[model samples]
Target: MAQDDTPSAFRLPDPAVVSRTMADVAERGQRIVQDFLKRQSDNASNGGGTGGAGSDPLNLAGAFMEMTTRLMSNPARLMQAQIGFWQDYMTLWQHTARRMMGKETGAVISEDPKDKRFKDDAWRDNEIFDFIKQSYLLSARYFQTAAASAEGLDEKSAQKVDFYTRQFVDALSPTNFALTNPEVLRRTAETGGENLLKGLSNLLGDLERGKGSLQISMVDRSKFSVGENIAVTPGSVVYQNELMQLVQYNPSTEKVLKRPLLILPPWINKFYILDLRPKNSFIRWAVEQGHTVFVCSWVNPDESLAEKGFDDYMQLGPYAALEAIEKATGEKNINAIGYCLGGTLLAATLAHMAAKRDTRIKSATFFTTMVDFEEAGELSVFIDEEQLQALEDKMNKRGFLEGSEMAGTFNMLRANDLIWSFVVNNYLLGQEPFPFDLLYWNSDSTRMPAKMHSFYLRRMYQQNDLIKPGAVDLLGVKLDLRKIKLPTYILSTREDHIAPWQSTYRATQIYGGPIRFVLAASGHIAGVANPPASGKYSHWVSDTAPPTAEAWLEGATELAGSWWPDWHRWVSALDKAQVPARTPGDGALAVIEPAPGSYVKVMASD
Candidate 1:
């Protein structure tokens, strides 16, 4: 008997099950809509009508308008772009038609190998999905090219246009939507529309958590706590102040380097990023390496801390920690390390101490820090006059910048990874985010004091004044980077979006002291938090300093494994006098509390 020449029917979800799921999804969606409307109503009654600071806070419209004017002026160029877009689509259509006819045809366009959005086999093997993928890619390229090619606009405006254009394009990716995404479609079919219902529930939960705004949950927050699973290194809070609490870890070795290590982490996030877990904890590793490690855990500021300024952070933070360290260890000289914003502050404090003839801090190390903000990376797109004024207005009203707002800005830097990935996992695919220590710490953002944040943005980012001698005044002392003469080590990540390695490398030219610059392989957090045991990212080291970052990289030697050992060797070489290990409260500064102190435990929502 001849085989039946009939096409098999597609597997469809049960109508009753789909109906029930659709009803539940509709109910959840309706609640979300109701909550959003109520929020808008409350805002309107409170004299907030989506105007002034509320609308166009980033001044995105102005940049896009300028780009549009520039593009309109060159009609021939615009027409040429339109023609090119159609030509690509035509090629894609031809390729897709051949694919449907069982002909082996090359793709009209392909995604970057790093692009994970189209990693599913169906995106390549299925003709319809392949066409959809290429169409999106082609359009994304067209939009980005147009934005980059905008003429007559200033550098800042051009950057804004390009950056936001990419964000818009990324948002419109087929993978972010349920109907367009093959993975989501497959999951939906397998679950019989249950995934859509769950997705709606997740969407509602996120909306409710954000109080009408969408705050996509990036990790399972229930799985981790600050002082419990993560940040579990044994230590005590030796010193506390309004701005920060200095935690002095109990030494792991019998003897430690005489010069204790004080770490000043950025106040924008908690210090536990360095102490996430024992294996990857920089704090734990440092203590094991025979160094008395002390870290400053910054407070999550509120309206009450509104008056605090950058000067207060410097004096009450690292400076206060310095005096306390002296009383604790009975040592006048010490070594210091700072990460990101903290590193910038450390550089300034070094200058302040230089003028006062205070030589307590013998060595300094900066992790992805930028003293010179001339090329401050994509973050500069948010630092223009209009946006600053708008941001100041918002902060002035609340006495501090909301942690969520700052988090959103940072997320925009790597939207595909930080923002869209969560959107797909938690909303589109109806899957809960994996339990991740780094993302948990990332979600636990800290508010910035209005005065301090304003001073930082205006001085460092907008005006680019930190690099100039006497450009910044702190506690009656002019902060000149040139005056900071301590032996310095600057570690910059090659893929750092927040602090470009080249921008951070400019510090080598400014400081009077001998400098060693090292470039590590991943982005900001992963590169810095890498452990030797993990054997993950590689780093580059060079003894000589070149005028340009590119030249420095050209002569640098690529080495395998983490840069932590290299750093330990360099810091230890500074002053390797050994002393008997001292416990947290063994010295004059008594223990106030346990490690990962109360300050870090305070959530932004709280």
Candidate 2:
């Protein structure tokens, strides 16, 4: 085979960095040797002691013995689990063999239906491929058993072990292997091994780009620009402050709802999630429904904005937007909606308004937002004393948390789907990532201010301060959710990993109002973004607030289609009669530019 010459694909980093790294590594090696010798000498002086039992090499042996003993102690349960695994394995083999022999096997063996790699016909048609799939499945089952068998480990530590083990298992799947992956092999043949060359190129490119780590290209950054491809809802930047840009979308109907709708989207990411595509856009949908909508497009923070804290967000974010909306629309009251972290701020603003006896916001809607941080889910794992301190140190140095750093933490929460899938596709298979709007939005993260990020994580996540009345002070006012008496609409996703449905449901008890909590199907983003056209998922609705989330779920009526229509009807009831439609600049506030605003366009420094 002739070696097909391809141009060198990637540039090497500066040679100065390589030299510095080499010198630093040598210095570190010397330091490590010296430390080890010092430690040994200290141990000898201390009567041949090496810390305690946990640190002793013999204790590691004892730990292994304890593990074996625990396994031995649970012989019956172990035997039962092992037997069940073997039964499943045997069934899979029989089915695979029968299928390969061109015999009809009615029901296929699948441990996890979510695993898509085995769905390919090539895996079933080829005997070797079939065996490989079965083998991996069987191994995965064994790994689950092994993980379950482990005892005496902390919950978080155990979870880490299980998670990494699963990642290892998933990485070893036939789909990732060059020979077993049909698509890679086919492309290799068609391209005369150029696919492999490109794959190597992609790998090198990611390495050079990501520096040392693999930052898999999850989104086609070039495909979607802020105002062009997405966030195209017709609107104008009515007001600009240091923290956010207030966008009042142009009304689509002749008669709009009397009360204006103000959106507070999470600053953790760009605000365009609510306005992704015309069909899927919530802002567009709301406008078509005869409502005056406004959204706060948050400014991506840098070192200059590092001093901006949660208080700044409260004062300049919702409060400032409320004043601007009132000024523009000539409506005394506004219907405010908050998503995720934005929701938290919105709740705080409501409490602040309640304290001041302000009637600017008549009604409120929270989308997959958590007021009670007691059950913030997997995100809490990354927040602790040591972790927070380390994070603070990083923020202190940089003045803001890097968007990539924040995004990396989120990607870790769903590593298999968000991280490894891209790794296999982009680097291993040498494929450009499929255009996904959600992923594109997710990749477009915003930096968090040092003071603001620290305050949010420590006060909300670590201490669970938000749930306690008067515990959190925002803008010189103690935030008490119970003070909020306006009619509230809460939408929590049944499968939300970020804000668990229960924690979101807890918001019902926090506020002093008639709460209409709806449990939407799918995860955090998808549930909220669900459109009526898809007809894919269903949502649960409850008229009366229940004692617990489980209780609410039990009595809840499952409704078909998107929850948007249901919410629209609910909000319409709270709002006044229809009035003449108002354009962005038609009001007192002048329009700066089109919708999606300039604040959202401002990119965080790399």
Candidate 3:
């Protein structure tokens, strides 16, 4: 509902099955039933098993009887639910009769106030429509309650059922139907059926582009370009390696912190999420705050880099950038920030540095990164043994995991906003996607190398290795979060599904440092990119570090403004004396091009 200039950092599936598979399954089932029947017939004909003619029919129907008994285990609960439903229906009927007798102005079946779909007057004004809407809503509520009340289901299985139930309920909304939706019908008449034709064309285009699947593009790509329009933060690409490019932003302040700020963004996405246009650019903001900013622009890895593992990223990404930043700024000590997966890598790199006694990293900042994957939210659902094997098989076929696959996973977390909303707007309404810079960045996805991705999932999500000391060996050392004692500032978004705030809060427990964890409002991208100038959303802050994330929330003070200023203050305290601004290529590292280097421009492989 609110405005966000930057897209979600998470910007962020196919079915093809021959009929032969289903036919085979059907034939197999048929054979089993036929064979069982034949066995019974043979036994009866020979009188080898039992005498059927003399036997009671109930004895022959034993299997059916057993199944029915098993199904009615909670007969009391079933009866109570039936009684409750009938009671509610009768009450509604009585209320409706009263309303019809001029005692009430509206229908007894009022839509749930919490229901966002039927907020329009049309749904409320017509008693018939209101009844239909309310009935569906009530039914949906009952279904969800039934799902929650289900026995013998694990938490994950119950959650999956609940999520699917929501999807089912969302799909059947009155707004999605043409005839039931007055607004859509009104638009249809106003357009003289033009909208329908355009919708068909749009649907066909999507199916064609998506290879028989519907992929609703969130932005009009034709209206925007990466460097020119969206990622327009003023900076120069000062350093490059096989894994990443370091961009040194042009300084806004005359003097800057002696300890230069180095950013490690997730290779899963382009680095421009931090530099999304000048107005909301975090990189631009850092430069203006008298800090020398260097961002890592990760390569859109292809098949050639499939074998590149997590260790490769550690050495080539942060380590390489650290060397380049030191050379460029002549600053021995550096302040570092890592975002999402980037933050996870930063934590590992920090631990590695601690083991080697490398003190170049003075202060560490993490933006929505998870060190412990114990409560990894919905993402854990995709990381089981079977799913991992399937993913590996898919990635093996194509050296790198496709960007769209990653995007789809994140989109599933918020299907209404990311998927169905687009479905209604782009396909049903036949409208061109909005020309949004954030959405454009979201659409411009990047690939992940197979080996690196596999290692990451297995180690972090599957094995739960990173947080455990001596569990994960990276760069010839056991990666331990407890070893790192650098001054740390960790931030997590309140509404982030990708890196849930509570999951991110685990870092405070793992990191053996003076860690300050702040919970910002909004989602993954918007939360981090929020500018104080906009004054859009409020953030929660506290000095106390509690054992549990919930306890932290209880003590945290709700502050009105962006967390950027708080971060600037925190980093300022740790920084050395201010020195004159240093330009890109002014020191050891030579300039390659402008900021947002060639790596970002490389489109996802077809």
Could you say which candidate leads in TM-score? 1
Candidate 1 clashes between residue pairs 3 or more apart in a chain or in different chains:
none
What is candidate 2's lDDT per residue for 1-606, written digit by digit as tens? Answer: 856445432334346655654565566545555666776687568555534432432123433455557667878877887888888778877876787788877443444778666667766666767677777777787876776686676554454455556666777877877887766665665655545545665665554445444567787787888899888999899998999999988888999999999999999988898999998999999999998999999999889988999999998998888889878988888899999999999998899888889978888999999988886777876665656776776688669998988898888777768877776678666788878889988888789999999999999998989878899988778878899999999999988878899989998888888889999999999999998998968999989897799998989899998999999999999855989999988879998888787788877645
Q: Give the range of the ten consecutive residues with the poorest summed lDDT in model 1.
A: 3-12
Give one digit per residue, the lDDT tens place, for model 3 in 1-606. Answer: 864434221110011222443454455546555666786787557644544423432122333344335336766776676677677666666765665565764443455565556766767666656666766666666666655555655555555556656767777776777777665565666655445555656665565455434566888889988889888888899888888888898888888888899999998888888888788988888899999898999999999999999999999988988888878887788999999999999999999999999999999999999989988887876766656776786688679998887887888887767777677676566687899888888878899999999999999998889988999998789877899998999999999989899999988888888989899999999999898898898999999789999999999999998999999999999755899988888898888898778889998845
List, residue by residue over 325-390, the lDDT tens digit for candidate 1: 988899888899999999989999999999999999999999999999999999999999989998
TM-score of each: 0.96, 0.83, 0.85
RMSD of 2: 8.1
Please list the C-alpha lDDT of all candidates, in the order they appear.
0.91, 0.81, 0.79
* Off by more than 4 A, model 1: 1-47
Candidate 2 local Cα displacement, residue 503, angstroms: 2.3
Please report how far candidate 1 places residue 468 from its true position, in Å: 1.7
For model 1, what is the alpha-carbon lDDT of residue 491?
Answer: 97
